[model samples]
Target: MLPAPSRPPRLRALAVAAAGLVVLTSLTGCTQIASAFNGLQQNAVSTPAPRPAVTQAVSMPYDSKFTYDGSVSLSTDVADGLEVRLDVWAADPKRTQEWAPDNDKTFGFAVNVVDHRVDEKAVLTQKRRVYMSMISITSQVSQSTIGQQQMMSPFQFSADPRTLVPSDTMRSDRGLLLNTFQGGLLVPTTTIHQLPADTYGITLQFALQVWVEGTANTDTSFQQQTVYQVLPIAIFSPTTPTQ
Candidate 1:
C-alpha cells in the first residue's frame, strides 16, 4: 500500500492534547456528582427530626349569679415543724348565688396551727406553740371604671385577734392562743360592699400575724411571723341570669 500520508507534527500534537482534555473533563464531572451525593447523605444522617407544636389554655370569667365552689384550703409549712391551715368560704351560699356587681359579698374564714413534731393536744403547752396577733384583708378588682368606688371594709375588725377569743383563754401580749382546746379560731363573717360597677373579678388577700414560741416552754420567748392566703371571686353580670 502506498505509504499513508504522514500527519503533520503540529496536527498530531493537537489531537493528543484534545483527547487528554476530554478524559480530564469526564473525571472532573464524576467527582463533582459524587461530592454532591455524599453531602446529601450526610445531611440526612445529621439532621434532627421535626418537633410537635405546643399550646396553652386560657381562663374565662364565670357568670355573676353562678353558684361556684366558694371554699379554698391553704396550708403553709414556712415555720419550722409548724403547719398552718386556712379555710375560707362564702358566708352564705344563697347570698353568693345572688351576688352581683355594685353589691356586697361576705366571707367566713378560720385559722388552725399544728405542730408535726408534737401531739395536737399538747401543741398549746409545747414550746412550739403558735399564737395569732392580727388579721386583715386587702382587696383588688379585676377591672374598674372612672369614679367607681373601692371597698375598705364593710365592717371594722379588731386588729388584735385575742379580742375575738374568750377571756378565759391563756392571756399573752403575743395575741390569741391558737391550737386551743376548741381546735382553731373562726371569724363568723365579714362583708365587702360597693364593689366597682365594672368589676369582673375580685381578689382578697388575707394576712395573719402570729408568734411562734422559742426554745422555752414556760416563758414567752416568741418569734413573730406572718401567714398569707388569697381568695378570688368571680362576679356575675348585672343583666345575666343564674346559669
Candidate 2:
C-alpha cells in the first residue's frame, strides 16, 4: 500500500474545490473525471505542501469569473528539503490568443485540450515553491503491489519532482512568469470535460512540464505521480465571452 499523502490544509481546500467543481459541473451534465498515471512512485523523503493565497477576477456586467483557490504542497528528497525545484508559471492572458483568439476567449485552462501554443520557452519563478508529482493510486483487491493502468487520452507533459531555486539568479523576463504577468485574477486549474452517462469511470492523465533548473524536464519519471481524485467533470460552455 502506498503512503497516505501528507496533504496540507490548503491542498484539502483545493481538493474540496475540485470536488465542488464536479458538483457544479453536474448542473451542466458532466461525469467523473479521473487520472491514470503510468509510472512508479518512489519512497523518498517527502516534504510538506505549500500554502497558497487566493485572488479573484469578476465582471460587473457579465457576472463571469473565478476564484483562485491557492493550495499546494511541497515534496522533497534531500533532508534539508527539495534540492531541485519545479519552475513556476503564471496566468497566460494570451493563452486563448495563441490558439483561436477570435474563437471567443476566456481566462482558464482545461484538461484534455491543448488549444493554446503553451509557450515552451516561457519560464517564471514562483513566490514560494512548486509542488508536483501529486499522483493518485488505487490498490489491488488482494495484493501487496501497485496497479498498472494507462489513461485513455494522456496529455504528454514533464514536471520535476521537487521545487528549484537558482544558485545565482535569473532575468526578470526569464523569471517564473515569462512575460511578467501576475497569476490570473483567479486560480489556474484544470477544467474537466463531461463524459457519457453510461460510462462508470474514465481514466485521465494531466501532465505538467517543469523546468527543474533549465528549460524543462523531458523525462517521464520525475513528473508528478499518483492518480488524483475520481469525481464528476463540470461541463459548460462560456456563458458569455469577454472582449
> Against the true structure, whose TM-score is highest?
1
Per-model TM-score, in order, reads 0.61, 0.23
lDDT of each: 0.54, 0.23
After superposition, which runs of candidate 2 have C-alpha atoms over 4 Å from their true positions?
1-8, 12-80, 83-190, 214-243
In candidate 1, stretches whose alpha carbon ends up further than 4 angstroms from where it belongs are: 1-67, 95-97, 144-158, 180-183, 216-221, 239-243
In model 2, the number of clashes is 26
**Cα error of candidate 1 at position 218, Å:** 5.6
**Which consecutive 10 residues in model 1 have the weakest lDDT in total?**
40-49
Report residue 199 deviation for candidate 2 (angstroms).
Answer: 1.4
14-112, model 1: which lDDT tens digit per residue? 334322322223545434433433333233211222323433322356432223644556777746787777766565433454556766665655666
Candidate 2, residue 169: lDDT: 20
The residue pairs found clashing in candidate 1 are 64-236
